[model samples]
Target: METKFLVSLMFLQAIINGVNLLRPPDQHGSKCSKNGDLNSNVLLKSRDVALDELYKSFRLPFTGAQRSNNGGIWAHALCPPKEKMEECRECVKDTIDFLKKDCPKQKEGATWSIFPHFYCMVRYADHPNQGNLAEWAWVQFNAPPGPGNATAGELEKAWNNLANTIMEKATEVKNLERYGYGSVLYGPHPQNLYGTMHCAPIIYQM
Candidate 1:
């Protein structure tokens, strides 16, 4: 029992570290910006539905979210609209769904943008002409290392580099565009293959 508990704790720690290292930073919650209008009142069901509908229409290969109105600032990370659209959509959908049950009528919230990396996702109740402005939110996570790996230290370092590269490239693109942005590694079991992440700055832009 002691051994199992220790292992479980270690596994959890590794997962957390992995998330921090691979995921890029993202600001969470609705901190109204200078250009944002705090009076928008995003709690209205109609506006929420509009935001969701607009978010789903992009047809990108991944999931995305926006604050609605003002071009719906859209942003994404590694992964392309042509490749992992479903994963992207589901990711954002899952967050909102979870919050609906979890927060209950809350207007502002944020989540780990990346599935299991340093990536961050965020949105707020700033809608209905209240204005939006969370352009460059920061969300940083760190991954230490795990045991039982052929090259634990080496893989961890590589994963860190992969996460950095993906986010660095992802944020530079103009809104509305998609990036097949992601990182991978060569191996057998965890041969390390396939990664996807995205962001949407346009929707939340005030």
Candidate 2:
């Protein structure tokens, strides 16, 4: 079934001429349920089992996990195609720690983080169809005005072109990697503008 609620933390970063143009308003970008059902031992058991399996199965750049039985928990994790094994594991571990603290009672959670060496995402839900785009929520980060004399119109045009190209390329990606990246020239100074995108390896519906 489709997941009913979603909690996601997405980070976006844009750099130009050694200056960061995009930053998250909330560094944590954490979302959690206000009230937790701590006394629900069944749910707690399912959550623990699901998380354990997720960590164990998180070998590939993209992976998914589900409880051995129908405990109603499913999880997915992702790292950049070129991410190192140790770095990806560390990122996932840190992300899982954040979810355990910030979403203590939550049935589902997702987080995206980009580090200097690697980037990753961890998502878990009680529903099986977590791959469905309709079950996802998004947070947008707006970049500040272009540095120097570049107008908003010019910036938007360059960004749109780059974004569109990246998205299309991402769709064309095949096999398990499912990632795409590109860069373009921008502004009067002609600094480089870069973009990247990824899609889940597979989708399941129930």
Candidate 3:
């Protein structure tokens, strides 16, 4: 019963995170075509279809990228490491809905959202492999709310150390999903800090 209750809590948290993490399109810049170009229309249509397929059938705890026929559109979706299948589905659903609303006319777009249990990413573009993190056009996020019992300098130092560790561990593994997540305790209060890093499979190959 405890396990079931925990799962229920996670689901609720995921829904809340989906809503709270959404950001404005301008903060990430617009990649959508402005001139109503015919190719852009085709690409948009294809992207929509690809996103639908991915939402319908993607493996949990992994990253998947799909391309439309004739390669006019590409889309990618990723769930947080070790996410449950149902949670992953919900995350992808939320991500798709958010993208459509936030990037209504964009030819390319991407978003990263933090859910209570995990995080998810969704992106699409007119060209293939646009989901590659190294090639992503934008990265935006507010700083962590407040320093938790630690000085600003201590928090920065801890964050840098955690980030570097995650990166090193993520890259050391040559796999389809090269990502890592872990926690560390630091400072006089020994507050626990969590971090995660990921690169799309294509990015690893490149």
Candidate 4:
């Protein structure tokens, strides 16, 4: 049977460092779209400028910025609230570096990265719809297999319960950051399954 996990890109969560219950989503894809007559030099220049502002926009944990008049380059960066200031900046910087290296001249690009920690995203585009929920990207990471002798049925049941708890907790608008994390017991084992979720704060503005 083909099992599918449908997660809203709004909130990123789960996949702890060592347990390997899930592999944290990381740098799914760096999409680059060319537009207009912006020469390569001008494009990179504008992108770099916008990226600088984008990085600086994170005075708070979550923020976005826009630059240029011709088509424009817009960017957004997010890191979970629990993440440290320096680490969050580092995680966001990694995404920025990925865009700079992999998507040099493209007028538009976006990337969701799990560097340092699994809770971060950085995206840039020429259009102004950075806040559009309908436009999003994702990548799913699956665990190797059920741990111990827990049957597939038992494992699936435990996973469903964990996903539901995390989804509900993640969707709560408790703060402007709009992110949450939780863990649930797995079968009769002493081990607990973990997960986390986060949505772009701007989603609320819409």
| Candidate topping lDDT | 4
Per-residue alpha-carbon lDDT of model 2 for 159-185, expressed as tens digits? 677766765665673634555567777
- What lDDT score belongs to each candidate, Candidate 1 first? 0.39, 0.54, 0.54, 0.57
Pairs in clash, predicted candidate 4: 10-198, 10-199, 11-198, 12-198, 13-196, 14-196
Model 3 TM-score, all chains together: 0.67
The TM-score of predicted model 1 comes to: 0.43
- List model 1 lDDT by residue over 1-206, tens digit each: 43233222111111232223444333222222344322334434533564465336546333333334323222222223443556655555555544344334444433444454333233444343222333333234444553325365666566555555555554565635423255556333344423443444343234
Model 4, 34-135: lDDT tens digits are: 454346666657667777775554564233311222225556676667756666677677778876776776656666665434446666666556544333
Model 2 lDDT on a 0 to 1 scale: 0.54
Per TM-score, the best of the predicted structures is 2
Q: Candidate 1 vs candidate 3: which has greater lDDT?
A: 3
**Candidate 4's C-alpha lDDT?**
0.57
lDDT of 1: 0.39
Q: With candidate 2 superimposed using the best TM-score fit, by how many Å does residue 197's alpha carbon deviate from the native? A: 1.0
lDDT by residue for model 3 (53-138), tens: 76677653444332232346567666655556667777677777777777777667766665554566676666674433332344
Q: How many clashes show up per model?
A: 42, 0, 2, 6
List runs of model 1 lying over 4 Å from the truth: 1-47, 50-52, 55-80, 83-95, 111-122, 127-152, 172-180, 186-190
Clash-forming residue pairs, model 2: none
RMSD of each: 11.5, 6.0, 9.9, 5.4
Error of 2 at 166 (Å): 1.9
